[model samples]
Target: MEKFIGLVGTNSDNSTNRKLLQFMEKYFADKAQIEIIEIKDLPIFNKPEDKQIPEQVQLIADKIDAASGVIISTPEYDHAVPASLINALNWLSYGIFPFVDKAVMITGASYGTLGSSRAQLHLRQILDSPELKARIMPSSEFLLSHSLQAFDEEGRLNNGEHIEKLEGLFEDFLTFVKITNQLNHAHSINKKEAENFSWEEI
Candidate 1:
């Protein structure tokens, strides 16, 4: 079965983004394994001092390294990704480099009309940087605006249109992950073949 890591951008226990991830876990349970990683336990990034990663951070890194894809649910804070999420990414980029060439899908929930759109854009830019090099899905954004009303008492999405869109996004993301993994495997094989080729004089 394909494994995917789910991360919530905020540290709040009651964050709507977290609920959104839970909903996704239930919605896609049969299709894939979605394991939610808690950001609350991660230490604030301190660069050189943090070279020796904490056990919790290493655990998350290991999961990401083993996963077929990653899904992030983020909330906008001051028009950007929450600090906790940024810090976690910083740690991953330092040495783990788990995001390199990995398939990623970004979504967000917010009280505002834009629904964390600005934060997701910023995150895409960060993931595209040389150090990270994450391959994020280019279409079918899953932003949830006015998030308070987006879900029902039972925690399922209230809007049928949004549910349809999310299902479509998940399907596309799975395809993207599979294709990307195959391409990477092929590239590695080709590189190994090229390296083993012997040149001879005719």
Candidate 2:
């Protein structure tokens, strides 16, 4: 019953990041339910003492809360992620506390020499808030310089090695979700015993 959510950061219909997401969608199509989180319908976050949460923001939070894991895809602008993604996280981190303990992975595309390395690093820092349990792939590394030509003219990844890398990353991420879900299930079965089970025991 684990659900996977893909949070796409760019607002462009032809975004290269979105194309990457689409490739991911295909790769994970049979593994779990994948929900694409779009930024087009969201509004900027606002902190008001008397205002209620916006419907759009609440909708996003509800989805995030319901999903078991999330994949964050974005574009790097000025050495950081897009404003849309920042705003989305802002909404989730409002007094509502939407991202708590949510497993997350981030990926991006950039035209620069460094690719999206700086932007992804900044994203890792921002998402390290107390509410979220974001998990990133250290070895999967960055995909930037060749990202422009990595995809075929039809927008699909044409390189066999890159596709294999993505598949491996996806498998690893799914394993993470499975392990966490098992732990949660174990805790539910017997909270005390689950707590007592040592890491070596696991």
Model 2 ranges off by over 4 Å:
131-144, 182-202
lDDT (10s digit) by residue, model 1, range 88-133: 8888877566777889999999987998999999999988865577
Q: CA shift at 77, candidate 1, in angstroms? A: 1.2
lDDT of 2 by residue, 34-144 (tens): 788788667777766664778888888788878888888878888888888888777776655545455677777776666688788888888775434344444555464
TM-score of each: 0.89, 0.81
In terms of lDDT, which candidate is strongest?
1
Q: What is the TM-score of candidate 1?
A: 0.89
Instruction: Compute the lDDT of residue 32 as modeled in candidate 2.
Output: 74
Model 2: how far is 54 from its true place, Å?
A: 1.4
Q: How many clashes would you count in candidate 2?
A: 0
Best by TM-score: 1
